[model samples]
Target: MYDWSALPRGARASLSVAGLVMAASFLGFGALVRSLEVGLLPGLATTVFIWALPGQVVALDMLASGANLLAMALAVTLTAVRLLPMVVLVMSKVRLEGARRWPLYALSHFVAVTIWRIAEDGIDEVDRPQRLPWLTGLGLALMSSMLVMTSIGYHLAQSLPPLLAACLVFLTPSFFFISLFANAKFRMDYIAIAAGALIGPLCHQYYPEFDLLAGGLIGCTIAYLIGRAGRKRSK
Candidate 1:
């Protein structure tokens, strides 16, 4: 194993907390949905592979309704498009140092909001060589938690209160926004997230499958334009 001891003390701690938070918010909901039998093994498999919550929701929901497998795949793929840029940006940061490339590819599969938060905080101080091991630890820890919690939720779905479960479903986004509010460095990200949040849902009411993927594009465009105008005016 790589030297994970190199992770900054604060970063390692922060990553652990973020992973637990994600578990509290999301794992139960996934289990509940699974228990309902609306989405079964195939859908859960997608959760492992696809990783994006929105796309998983769409896939399971559509698949449950007997939607064509090809359509389900396309929709999930579209929703996941956001990760391409995000992954690239993160990789660009650590790639120049050049650690083992294989684990980076393996770790990429587990990269999601929880791990992302921890990685962002933990890797800042670590040397380039150690960035990935720290990330691997973070990813592995969170993925294990998710798998465990989902199984628990699946079995206990009947006992868990529906109202509380609903709240749990929103936890991911809530933590996400809280992270955004705390950590947003760029004006564009702030604007883009807010616009995307508002427009993404509203657009969903009209176009459920495409709302997030497409609204994100539109919201990003508008936010970028606004940011550009603001920058020019400030200068």
Candidate 2:
């Protein structure tokens, strides 16, 4: 139902901004790995293979501490497990019945936080058949940009000034926050964001080891409960 020709314009524009932000984010990550003396090749491999920033951070931090292999594996697994809900939500929207399973398997790797937000916001504008291709192109472009930036960050870590490097690292989350606020359509979205902001720092202070997981679970649960109560009261 959709033509590939219509993909270029939107894909190009979206990629321009999103790719740059992703690149900046990974550049900071690469530099962090370099500063930790984690070996350039292994850091690049983590970026390519693990592909999740938070998981990579956890792994690198554990490795630096000379944590046990089992503990590191468990931590990485826990961080990556957060992606499951994201992948499920995304697949529901773009996947077609009777499509080849292999491609879907491949595409699932691209369903990280950034891609999820972009796809969730833009998928409605795309034809059903073309949604996958649009997302595929967007993911590929962002991934490629991050890889290149990671290399730049790793090799040039020394030459890049500390302040500039810090700015690059901050760009990703800043972009994510802006994008989330811009696209928010419901009261629940605001509630979730506010809850996370308030709860996340407290968790980090009290339970640094499990801060991310604890904050997410508690914040999301509270947000859900509040939304449900509001809906019932409205009726």
Candidate 3:
């Protein structure tokens, strides 16, 4: 039997609002999988393997649409490209000096937005040597909850109202923004968030194909330039 008490602080922290929100968001994905007539196993596999909601959704949609394997792969790759920067940020935080490379590589798979956010919020409190273990535990705990919730949502999809099921998918980003605002430590962070909020829709309206990429690039660049100027003035 597993010793629940022995779980790391990061794992224990998973018993919070972040975990619940992640589970809820994935529950909607599970419903989507079922509604698409995809089997539960494939849905659970996406949670375990892809481990990113955007990629999972894209793959499922493509699969349902009977897209060719190469096209599906390319589409999923594009959707997941956004994760590269996130992975870099989280790895920088949790990587130990002179630590073995393989474990960090394994840990990189768990660096989804929710995990990254939780790590950002709590990782500083953990000792360096324990950081990897703490992150491992946290990732596993969250993943386990997601797996269970996904299954539950799959089973419940038939009874769930279509509108309610669709709304559930928004829970993760809603929680993410709330947490981002709560934990934002710099003016630039807020500015970036505001800029993205204002610019994203405008880009979507005019440049629908590359709205996210364009919005993020433009918004963050503007925020970064302003932040740099502020720092120069302060000095």
Best by lDDT: 3
Against the true structure, whose TM-score is highest?
A: 1
- Weakest 10 consecutive residues of candidate 2 by summed lDDT: 1-10
By TM-score, rank the candidates, best first: 1, 3, 2
Summarize candidate 3's per-residue lDDT along 143-233 as a digit string, tens digits. 8888998898887777777777666545545655686687577788888889978897899799654555566678889998998898899
lDDT on C-alpha atoms for all candidate structures: 0.66, 0.74, 0.77
Q: What does candidate 1's lDDT look like per residue over 183-212, in tens digits?
A: 576798799888988998899889876665
lDDT of 2 by residue, 1-235 (tens): 3344644554564555555666777887777777777787777777777888878877877777677787678778876886898899888888887776665677788788777877777689878777777777777666677778888887777777888766655654575567568756667778878887889789989976655556767887898899888888888
Lowest summed lDDT window (length 10), candidate 3: 1-10
Ranking by lDDT: 3, 2, 1
TM-score of every model versus the real structure: 0.73, 0.70, 0.71
